[model samples]
Target: VPPGEFIPVAERFGIASRLDRWIIRTALSRHGAALRSGALTLGFNLSAQTLSDPQLWDFVDNVIEETGAPHSGIGFEITETAAVTNFDAAEQFVRKARERRCRVSLDDFGAGMSSFEYLRRFPVDTIKIDGSFIEHITQSRFDREIVLAITSIARSLGCDVVGEKIEQQDTLAMLSDMGVAFGQGFLLHRPEPLERIV
Candidate 1:
């Protein structure tokens, strides 16, 4: 990951999706092997370009079938900008995923096009509030207002809201007060190799 040079290398080989599949397969396999242990879910970030394909749904179904992973065990994270830009195409993907009980998150939510219109059109199970807003909540009334508003709105829609990049104790307390259902950040656990997940 030096200089982040390998990111494009992954995309160039069309291996992003392949890598995602591997992670899903491995996570699910591990979870099953440790049935006596608790359940585990895997999160995968898909490139916006990948959503352009109508067959993406079928490919996901195949992966679930091959890995014996429940649709609920998989989480697909989509950027708000990409989703709003290609709402039509993304809608179909989201709907099909939901129909199959898969979880969908509006990644980096509240960062771009905070349009109520987009929220109405998007079918998602979770909203990952942008860390920028979370980080500044103690210092900015505007940030607190936005966080409060988003939490209220998302909860009313039956969607869970997660505060990201919550590094401070007060931030976690405030987010809990605002009724955020989940959190993810270094304050919690940094992403590690998949082998150690289970």
Candidate 2:
């Protein structure tokens, strides 16, 4: 199942934590060796349920040690909605992860209600601009403005900004002009298996 569908179902059944563990374990088992060799960086999305569970951190720490994956090569992506749901816990997660040399990013940044507020609370390494805004960024002045504003704020806070759903060259060029640090979508590269890339 897609994460969007599975996450809600798992949360409703109070099994999100178990699902999270499986996801983390599977990801590590598949790519941990390559990650340790510095072949590529891996990013994992943690559900809000898992983020709020204090015990999750200990589990993650154990997995990292067991896999010998470099902390610096791992990135945890906390959605804007998730970060806002439990600000304190999310802050703790980000801080602890940073302490372990792991990167923390605020995913789907503009999709949430309080995007800017979360930025002030969480010291994330990157902000992924929501694709809704990027889809028509070139044609719509409002979308362009939103992207500009997000990029500007992120830059001032020393956070790298990434534009999502970049399927057009014009959009890519616009994002580059706006100083977006990264772009993700079909125009650049399609998503491929980690093993294939490694």
Candidate 3:
């Protein structure tokens, strides 16, 4: 199932942090070799519930020490919605993660009304433009304008912009023109099993 369907339930049940821990441990253990060798840099999506957990970092440290994954190869992604929901905890988590040299990305950025305000507070390494906006960017002048504004502001903040859900050549061309350094979608490659990816 897509995480969107289940993550909220997990959060409401207060099991999201445990689930996040398991995901981090499993990904690191399974991909430890590639991560330690600097051949792969994996980003894990963190839930708001997980971010607020005080022991989250301790759990992360133990797992990373166990797996021997370099801090540089470990990354975390917090959704704009989640970040806005718990701003204080999110800010704290980002700061601590950054101190450990782990990259943090604000995913689905611009999907929230207070994105700019939160962006000013969260020291994210990247801002992933929401897929909703990218879906019809080529056909919507409004979408284009939003993307341009987000890209420009992200540039000023020295944060990378990653376009998501790109499905057509036109979308890729447009993103490239706008200087989006990275993007992820079916146009690039479809999702596959971790075994295949590794």
Candidate 4:
């Protein structure tokens, strides 16, 4: 199925929890060897609904125990909007994940409303500046300002900032100058089949 179709279908069928389980299970099953060997680390995106589900954490704990892979090898990315929508649950999820030594990142950090407030509350290790703010950042004064502000806030909060959709050298250079810790986009690397790496 196309990636876009999976969420709606899962929600409509009331199988979102099952879908989350399947995703985690699949990741562990597919990458168990590499993860155990310290050859690869895996990251997964958790939807707002999943973040609100404590059962998901239980499932993750079980997987960690079964695989014997270091919890630090797994990271979870939660979008700003999603985390803010259910702040309490997201906070709990973040704290619990951290307790297990898993890294948590706030994705699309500056795209949503009250991002700074969320940043203050969410104990994430990284914040990914929204791609909308990163695209054409060098040319658009507003975007550059937003990215700089987000980067500043992230830095103050002791979180690494990442610039997304950085498709130009000028933009990358601009982000580097702004103290962005990392960047992602076509200019750096394109998404490819995971099997290629495995």
| Clashes per model (N, Cα, C within 3 A) | 0, 0, 0, 0
lDDT of 2 by residue, 80-182 (tens): 7777778899999999998988999989988978888888888889999999999898899999999999999998899998999999999999999989979
Instruction: Order the candidate numbers by TM-score, best to worst.
Output: 3, 2, 4, 1
Poorest stretch of ten by lDDT in candidate 4: 1-10
Model 2 Cα displacement at 192 (Å)?
3.2
Candidate 4 yields a Cα-based lDDT of 0.83
Off by over 4 Å in 3: none
Q: Which stretches of candidate 4 lie over 4 Å from their true place?
A: none
Score candidate 2 by lDDT: 0.88
Error of 2 at 148 (Å): 1.1
* Better by lDDT, candidate 2 or 1: 2
Candidate 1, residue 13: lDDT:
83
Per-residue accuracy of model 3 over 28-77 as CA lDDT, tens digit each: 99998999888899999998888888888999999999989988899999
- Report the candidate with higher lDDT, 2 versus 3: 3
User: What does candidate 4's lDDT look like per residue over 1-198, in tens digits?
Assistant: 665688878766877667877888888877887888888988888777788887887789888788777788899999876677688998899889889889899888778787777667778898888899988787899988888887887888888888888899988888998889799899998778778867
Ranking by lDDT: 3, 2, 4, 1
Residue 89 local lDDT, model 1: 85
Which pairs in model 3 have colliding backbones?
none
- Computed on alpha carbons, the lDDT of every model, listed in order, comes to 0.76, 0.88, 0.90, 0.83
Best by TM-score: 3
Prediction 3 TM-score vs. true: 0.95
lDDT of 1 by residue, 82-130 (tens): 5665678888888888898888988888888654665788778888899
Between candidates 2 and 4, name the one with more favorable TM-score.
2
